[model samples]
Target: MKFNWMFLFTFLALTDLANAQFSSGNQFFIGANTTVSIHGLVLRPTFNNTVWSNKVLTRSPDAIVGEPTASIQQVHTFNEPTSFSGLVGLTYLTGNLNGNTEDDLQIAYFNPDEKYVTTTGSTVDKTIHFVSKNFTGFNNSFLRITATNANSVLPVTLVSFKALKEGEQAQLAWSTSDEINSDYFEVQRSAEGKIWNAIGKVQAAGDSKAERTYTFTDNSPANGQNLYRLKMVDFDGTYTHSKIVVLDFESNMMVSFYPNPLTEKLLIQADDWNEVKSVELVTKQGNVIPMNNSKAGSDPGSREYDFRKYPVGTYYIKVTRQDGGIRTQQVVKM
Candidate 1:
């Protein structure tokens, strides 16, 4: 059954906007060149997590209608029954109506209630074409079609990345919809868009239905403004980068030492002492003195250090985790 094409366009556009708000998986494609065509449309086999939708605009039979009008067509069957399917219409317009010339078309889908599911192996197919009916006879032309699933689709919405001051370190956090075949995410920082360096990597949530959250802390962030992004990598080795988010980090942690020029012992204190993993005493000549973990319990507060064994001049106290993470401070040896 066919309805007024104008009415259908309005209805579908509104539906798409509403679906995007609540949908976890949504994707769409637009074409401009006449040679462009959509080939295959595939939906995930586990229809439980996502919803699918389609819109097609064919060249109008009557040129008086101006540009062709779009409409929502009947849902067609895909080779896989579990997945949804539908036909997209094609038509001729005022411009070139040659059999080889292509027409513009778009198809989009979203999953309002998607729960991430892992597929061992899967594939899908679709078809797109342009047809014209004139006084002479009827002619049809096919357009090249492409298929993309949840894992490959780019997110239209921008997720906010916030920076927080954690002691002397800066932490970053962001969130995204569930993904599939996701290997890991690379965190990059840039002073200018022209050059960027990988700061760290976070393992992806893999394939999931629920909203996933990720966080990364910059242990050695440069002073002033910094830019950050997630370089998402797929299991197949393919990858896509995310938009840049900028952050400004200000460090204000105070470090103080007592018993000036002390040969035997030295005391250190800092406000907001959460946990101190390890304490190290390094000499001016780059020699590391003996150090140890001084916290009494699982969580440690501020404490004093014993430096009596070594002679005094100038030295560096490097507090680090037994795992090798280091935090440094300069001190004077008496």
Candidate 2:
């Protein structure tokens, strides 16, 4: 799939030539059938006489003001759907350097997953910054970019790092863009966010322009708060650590809502009704079924429901606990 040309041109910044005296200007051209890698995308440029004369632009009227505008058309294919995020830095030498000077170069990037642009640049280095937008998903994309605009090149640009609590397990999910030499990702956990131990490792893509996702379930996550991060290792043994994410795993008190495959009635029984605030019946398609409970304003654990009029099918008993916990169980109507 090709990226929308209207959207791509709108986001990219290209310097146009002004009415300035021609000093010594040099033109650079992208040779026919030339292949180049930018960010995490691999692009192959082919000649198109209608849209472009040749994939070429001259540099160094050297002033930044006289730079010519150029757009390189290329094709990028992916095996599966993907998304992208992270910094895109361009290399520039010969500058009055400082810690603050490099810091000021930070730019915002789009997050393909979140469906909205970020508010801030988030992080920055001499070669690392932020992306322009957040994309949701794509199988194959016709990627277009101003080739000369990128500088910083990292193997992996992590889009998201999140941890979800499932009972005593910590489900860790993360994604990356343009992974070039990535070897594998190590799932590390810490209780206090200080000392860390490696629990598991997931193999990396090695080289990929398409966004890639990875998951790791820490079956032995520490009780209470569990801190997690990814140790993304490269094929050459080089590695970088992702930002830390935390998950709070609280053991839920067991509850039973019974008589599965029942004829007409259903009963909900729980050991502790103090934590269970509400009980609701939801269809397989996610629509909630209204209940006519005799004790309408009473505790959820002591409730009963009549399903005689409802269709005989599968449903779910969704229970919302007082501690902001949610539990769901499958129910069947006979």
Error of 1 at 97 (Å): 33
Worst 10 residues of 1 by lDDT: 59-68
Q: At residue 285, what lDDT does model 1 achieve?
A: 35
- Candidate 2's TM-score reads 0.34
- Which lDDT tens digits does candidate 2 get at residues 245-281? 6565653757776688777877777778778776776
- Supply the global lDDT for candidate 2: 0.49
Query: On residues 98-138, what C-alpha lDDT tens digit does candidate 1 reach at each position?
Result: 22113222332222222111111222212323331111112
Q: Compute each candidate's TM-score over C-alphas.
A: 0.34, 0.34
Of candidate 2, the 10-residue stretch with the lowest lDDT total is: 63-72
Clashes of 1: 16
